[model samples]
Target: MAKKVLLRVYGMTCDDCVAHVKNGLEKIGKNVDVSLDGNAVLDIDNDFDPYKIPSLDVFNGRYKAQVKEIKDD
Candidate 1:
């Protein structure tokens, strides 16, 4: 099984921010999808818990990511 981690991010205002978040999350999950509207969805192994992940501050700390919801899929 795979788990979808929906993150409600903040301080992301452009395409660069989206890229930053995606790159950072890619290290933690197998697949990462980021939206410019302050949201990110990560597809990780079911054994991994999104809540245990650390805060994301990509692009020289210009933005921060927060986990908003977790779902099993």
Candidate 2:
């Protein structure tokens, strides 16, 4: 089973920011959903540590990502 992760992302102010976050997160998980309202959700493998998600530096350090919640899905 996969785990659902809710991330509180900061600095996402536009659609382009959402796209950048979604693309960056998709590299590490599945079903990536990013919003301009400062949130992201994805499905990751159970064995992976949700807290260890790397900083989303793909967009030139404009965004900060933190794990807000994690649960079974």
Candidate 3:
């Protein structure tokens, strides 16, 4: 079974910020699908947990993005 989720992120100030988050998620998910808005939706199969995945900032250790919300689809 696959899961879908919406992610609202803060610290995104422009298109590059959007791209940064999008790219980061894609890298983490590998084969999963990802799209970005003020938030992002991720569709995945398996035990991957969005909440457990470190924030973009945390992963990079630069504090560039913060997750604002996580919701099911």
Q: After superposition, how far is residue 18 of candidate 1 from its true place, in Å?
A: 0.7
lDDT of 2: 0.83
| Cα TM-score per model | 0.78, 0.86, 0.59
Highest TM-score against the true fold, candidate: 2
Q: Across residues 1-73, which tens digit of lDDT does each residue of candidate 1 receive?
A: 3888888777788898788778888877866889999878888887777776545436347776677888888
Lowest-lDDT window of 10 residues in candidate 1?
A: 51-60
Candidate 3 Cα RMSD after full superposition onto the native fold (Å): 4.0
In model 3, what is the error at residue 35, expressed in angstroms? 7.7
| Stretches of model 1 off by over 4 angstroms after superposition | 54-60
Ranking by lDDT: 2, 1, 3
TM-score of 3: 0.59
Give the per-residue lDDT of model 3 (tens digit) for 1-73.
3556555555555777666666777755544333334556666445776665555443464324334454444
lDDT of each: 0.76, 0.83, 0.54
**1 or 3: which has the higher TM-score?**
1
